[model samples]
Target: MEKKLKKLKTDNARKQIKKNQNIFNIWTKLLRISAIWIRFFQWRKWHKDHTYPKPQVGPLMVAEIQQAKERWITITQRQAFPEEINSLRNNQQVVRGPLRTLSPYLDNDLLRVGGRLENSNISANRKHPVILPRQHVVTEMIYREYHQRYMHVGPQGLLAAIREEFWVLRGRDVARATVHNCLKCFRARPSSLQPAMGQLPSARVTPSRAFAQTGVDFAGPLVVKLGLRKSTTTKAYVAVFVCLATKAIHLEAVSALSTAAFMAALKRFMSRRGKPSHIWSDNGTNFVGARKELECCFKKQLTGRTVPEELVEEGVQWVFTPPSAPHFGGIWEAAVKSFKHHFVRVAGAAILNFEELSTLLAQIEACLNSRPMTALSSDPADLQALTPGHFLIGTPVLMPPEADYSEMPDNRLKRWELVQKITQMFWKRWRLEYLSSLQSKAKWLNPTANVKIGTLAVLKEDNVPPLQWKMVRIIEIHPGKDGIVRVVTVRTASGQQLKRPTVKICPLPMGKEE
Candidate 1:
């Protein structure tokens, strides 16, 4: 009985949802039809009441075309449409009679072609088209008003919308030109070009031990059940440590984003991989605090006081890139991206407990470390491409082989010498294959002329109107070591200063006098 009741409830819920969707579809269709009808009526009223001048087609013809349209309308109304309208609409009405040429398209009180009424002689797609006068500011005003009505849709959309009720000469050309000069459209579009690529840093090219020069970053605020009870929960953050030279990764799960949490994560990393010489990361408050703590510890030890052995011996240096600069830490940022990619799939919709989440992160770290650094060899006879594990463990982590080393007569020689030789060989291959591969710049192509100070620009925002764009002037330019300008500081008319990337700004094309 209970099972039947539950099934009935589910069925009723689905039926209700379907009924609501059908109603919504019907209402939407009615609204669209009504809007189109209202737009047609407005166009008809506008055409009947407004008088416009002739458009300039060049010299040889110098009279108003609006007067010609008026004359043609009067002739058609009085049942006097000439057999040839070339002299009535296309030509100035210098002559009028039954002998005048009538327009080819004429039907009972309406001009009809292709079963459609010809309200005006201007044809964007018709021959013997009634030419709209250039002085017809009302026609252009109608076009502009319609363009704004559609939220600045492009020329093609505007042409389609305007063609439904009335016709105008060179309508497509006018729409195209109007859309081209639209300030709103220009502010919303993405930048067409970018500055040149910056040079690679020395750490990227230099050979070093795995994790000796590391980049650290945080990835998440994932919620995990804390205690045995499902109701108890806490937030967890993942700290990612990526080796700059080899691209190997280490992940630590911390309880919070704080100085204590980061310090603990750093200690865990150091414990397994050994202390890094230099750590590169963004200027997060926790990271800054950790650096201060490390300095204090070093000072205490220098004063002859006992400190943690790792703190005294490590002598780690924390290097912070500028604030809001994620690209500067792209190495570790990419590593974080990789971790999240695998994590989402593996933990899909599961509210894991803390221990479970931690274990999964460790497994993800192992999988990333084992991935091939380059494409796999197609030939069965050739060895596979080298990975970060090859530098760290002298073998792939995916299928770690059993220990096999030659026994030496002396205890110190065999184990130590073989490990050193294997690491040296890996570094040699890394320099030849991996380091050389980083030479090309995949993005930020050839540089253009630098943006000069005092230049006017609009700060781009998501889903904002063009008129609402903040007017700003470039006050400072920040060029990377490669001498390519990617970021700049701008001051608004309100005296507010903001630092924005070049991608987020659209500089106005200025005239020499302006």
Candidate 2:
């Protein structure tokens, strides 16, 4: 009996070995037909004289196992709908589940939708797409793959494309999350942060002497004739000085944009209107140079044993807004706009000599200063609406004479008392009319989340598309007094550093936390 059992086991082992050898031969032949090469010696070792070695695992078996491992959708479906699959196979009706209403059924061991469109002539995949769980990893991969395949479309479009072959549970929510997480989609249509509007600077709201706190800006490269007889022309720019307190403007024409030219214009401005205590301007090249020169002058005077009193008295503090931020110097920018509006109409296409241009600028300045600072009153008894010129010279620069208060009784008012009273009245009106108007924000009413250090962002550029905007990494943030981040310092991909306002920086969806 023992001898018979041993013989039977040997026969079974031989039969198993022969089956594996035949499968290996078929795989080798297929590889050869597909132009894949195997060493002749290796082939000979295995198949010499039509005799095979002991059977081992083959490439076909390994490949089949790998393919089965990759079918994550099947594994998930089996885990989620084992009862539904079993019931369908046994021809039993599905009782209660998310898929009960869909009338799901098994096709090739995979669950699919069995909706009313079974009789439609459309493709099988479209009529009954594979149902997937919304929160599963496989479903996310499929959503992302189809999203990119269709050119990173919006949530609805991505869902529509996915439903042609897949019916993801809560597909709209999944599609939205996928698109929101896509780096390319976020960068293509990025959103910039808009913090709440900041408080007005003290220089702008406080009452002071005209031109005491001033902002300066350049207006144009206006064409002016160099000589009347020769018709030779050159470019001339207007230097606009605006009072931060009163909004009165003074215009000076410069032959060129240079340190010396700007200094000369500054001297002219001070000669007409007294030297300002503080001057604010954008960081133009000329302004930067002027600031450096002033610093050097101060250093030299301090080093000397006997400093000149005139130099010390003439010292002016210059303030510059961040580079490339024109909005920071909006007071002077608005003044430049007012200058252009009048200059364009007065000068037109006619090119005038330097003297004529200067005269025209002076006339425009007078007109701008005379504009009403407050709304005009319909009642005739009310005093004329206050103007910037009123703060400067106690009346409109272009207005006609009014009834004389000089002849009033001594008890009513003296000359000095009348002057003081009129000055106080002007300031009181300015506080009630001009300063109160700034309380309401015109835009950016709501604050957004502040960008932190190490966040990725896109630097906005004029005349450039959003896709072409440079990627940047935030290295620093400059928050306002209200603790809202309005500006940030960033390093670009090329390693260049730039300071930009939050309005010009489009932050990516994912930050350092991700």
Top candidate, metric TM-score: 2
Evaluated against the true structure, the overall lDDT of model 1 is: 0.70
Per-candidate Cα RMSD to the true structure, in Å, reads 19.0, 8.9
What stretches of model 1 exceed 4 Å from their correct place?
Answer: 1-153, 157-181, 190-193, 283-285, 288-315, 321-325, 403-415, 460-471, 492-496, 509-514
Compare the candidates by lDDT and give the number of the best one. 2
Instruction: Put down candidate 2 lDDT per residue, 356-450, tens digits, no spaces.
Output: 99899899999999998767889999878888999888888888787886676676456679789999999998999888877888888877889
lDDT of each: 0.70, 0.81
User: What clash pairs does model 2 have?
Assistant: none
- Tens digits of per-residue lDDT, candidate 1, 379-480, equal 999766789889777776776567754463666776689778878888888887788789888987767888888888887765777667787899999888
Worst lDDT 10-window in candidate 1 = 54-63
TM-score of each: 0.64, 0.78
